[model samples]
Target: MNPTIELLNSHRSIRKYKSQPLPPGALESFIKAGQAASSSNHVQACSVIRVQDPSKRAQLAHLAGDQAYIEQAAEFLVFCADMKRNTEAAASTGIEPTLGMTEQLIVATVDVALFAQNVAIAAESEALGIVYIGGIRNNPSAISELLNLPEQVYPVFGMCIGYPDHQPEVKPRLPLEAVLMQDSYQEHEQAEQVAYYDQQMSEYYQARTGGNKTSNWSQSMAPMFGGKLRPHMRDFLIAQGFTMK
Candidate 1:
């Protein structure tokens, strides 16, 4: 495989990080690389907030399920889906641009995700460790207020970047046969595929945790699907001016 493919496959979430700061201008370079990612209609409806203040970081850490890595990482950033800039730019012209469309929300959210992934890849390429913190959505409103975000903007997620203090084994992924389909959406053999994959995952978890974690992929997903996960997200997005009309 090519070097890029190798790097992509070897990606791991780094929880513990060293105290060393990033090389000068590294963060800027990563952000710039993120900007290079494709956007819907080139809207580039995404923004990043670097949380440098210790007090704010501590509060954010608590809000995001007490993930201390948010405060401990050399750099922490909140990636936001921002349509405010586009709205203002459009208002500058003669037409009254529409707002609160579902498509608009989707575009902005997708843009933010793509941009953040690019930032992650760039950071990883530089031998830096990073972890995406989706827990920021746990209290999106509080985080938005803390970041001074305005309407037409919402926090999508946060990312932590720093030198690695520990190396974790790269997690295994679903088999190609289970995920990659033919010309159409085929599922005739899904049960068999999933069963096989589950066994593989069970073995992986067992080895990784020294038999402490015996749960497989299907079993581990119980909590996520058992109930309405993050039910507040709908109302929060609407309040942020993403009315999903």
Candidate 2:
């Protein structure tokens, strides 16, 4: 495999990080790479907030389920799906811009995700480790207020980036056959593929946790699917002007 493919495959979420700060210009370079990511119709509806305040980081850490790495990481950033910029830009040109269309929401959300992933790949290339903190969505309102975000902008997720203090084993993923299909959707093949994947994941969990975690992939996903996971998100997004039409 090429060096880029090797780097991509070796990715691991590094929770523990060193105290060392990033090299000068590194963060900017990574963000530049993120800006280069493709956007829907070139709208580029994304904005990233770099949280540098110690107290704010502490509060964010608490708000995001007390993920200490938010405070500990060398850099913590909140990636936001921002439609306000685009809407205002359009209004300046004398057009009455629409506020909250479902398609607009989708475009902004997908744009930010693509932008952040580009930043991740760039950071990884520089030997920095990163872990995405979706916990920010736990209290998106509080975080939004904390960050002084305006209407038509919402925090999609946060990311912690820093030099790794420890290396971890790369977690296994579902087999290629399960996800990559030819011609069309392969619904009939899923049960067998998932069953095989479940066993593989069960073994991976067992070894990773020294038998303490015996659950498989399907079992582990129970909490997310079984409950109304982050049910407030819909209301919060609506309040942020993304009414989903």
Candidate 3:
């Protein structure tokens, strides 16, 4: 197997870490790699906050569902979808940006993910391991305040980077057929595809928990979508100045 392919394929969340620190200049290289990601119209609506203070890291970990890993990371970064820089630029010159001005929220989200993934790949290439912290969204306001984020900017996610303490199994993903569609959208096969995916996900989750847990994809998605998370997200986005019409 190709070494590059192997690195991409073997990706998994690494929570635990060693005390070993990253080499000097490694982080700059990683940030450069992340900035190299493709952006729509070159907006590059991404910004990152590197958490260096121990107290701040601990507080962030507490805010982010008490995920201990966030504090343990040698480098913890909070990625944000930011339009402030662009807006500031436009306002300073007395001009407004073109269409989708309100949609910078979405663009920034993609930018954050692109940069985060790029950093992950670079970190892996350097024998380091990392974990993305989606739990940071659990309390958006708290995160924004903790990082002192300005308006028109929102925390998309957090990431933990450090030397690995353990190697976990790579999580399985949905089959390609479930995600890929034909030339024209076919509604008929969707249910079957979802059902197959549900079964695969159920088995995958169960295996991860040593057969102590069982949950189908449909069952798992409800809490994540229909539950409090969705309404809270809508509220959070609105408060963050993203008026989703």
Candidate 4:
């Protein structure tokens, strides 16, 4: 297998982090790696806010669903899906802030996530650990205020980075047959595939959490499908200068 593929297979979220600070130049190199990601027409519609102040980090942690790891990590980075620069560029010439269509939101998000993942992978190559904190959107309004984000810019997510305090087994993903689609899409075998994946995941969870089982896909998929997350997201986006029409 390829080296990148081997590294990808070992990917896992690290929640607990050691107190050690990153070595000199580590953060800079990570930023450089992020910039190397391909952008949409080189727009590079992403910006990172690195939080090192303990009090600020704590406030961000509270905003991110009270995840203590956000404050505990050696570094906290908030990646933003930004069109603020474009808004400026338009004013500089004769263009206008494009009221991004709902579908185009995916482009902004994918651009940001790709850069974030590049940084994560680069850091991991040097033995650093990271956890993507999607919960940052739990209180996006408050987070935006705290981060002093402008209109046309929104926090895509946060990341906690540092030396890992512990090593855990890789979480089980669905079998190749389940997700690796062929020429023609088929759903007939999904039931059996899910059952097998569920068992593998259940065992993996039990072992990771000291024999206490949390949930299986069937049990949690319902609430997730019901949109239990920030349901006012459309309204929120409008407030942030994104027209989802």
> Which model scores highest in lDDT?
2
Clashing pairs in 1: none
True-structure RMSD for candidate 2: 0.7
Q: Lowest summed lDDT over 10 consecutive residues: which window, candidate 3?
A: 96-105
What would the per-residue lDDT of candidate 3 be over residues 4-91, giving only the tens digit for each residue?
8999998988999998899999988999999999887788889989999999999999988899988887899998988778778877
RMSD to native, candidate 1: 0.8
- Candidate 2 collision pairs: none
Question: How well is each residue in 112-225 modelled by candidate 4, as lDDT tens digits?
Answer: 999999999999998989999998888889889988999889998999999999898888788899888889776998999999888887777778789887777666577778
Q: Model 4, which residues run further than 4 Å from truth?
A: none
How does candidate 4 fare on TM-score?
0.94
lDDT of each: 0.95, 0.96, 0.85, 0.87
Model 2 Cα lDDT, one tens digit per residue, 129-151 = 99999999999999999999999
State each model's C-alpha RMSD to the native.
Answer: 0.8, 0.7, 2.3, 1.5
Q: How close is every model to the real structure, measured as TM-score?
A: 0.98, 0.99, 0.89, 0.94
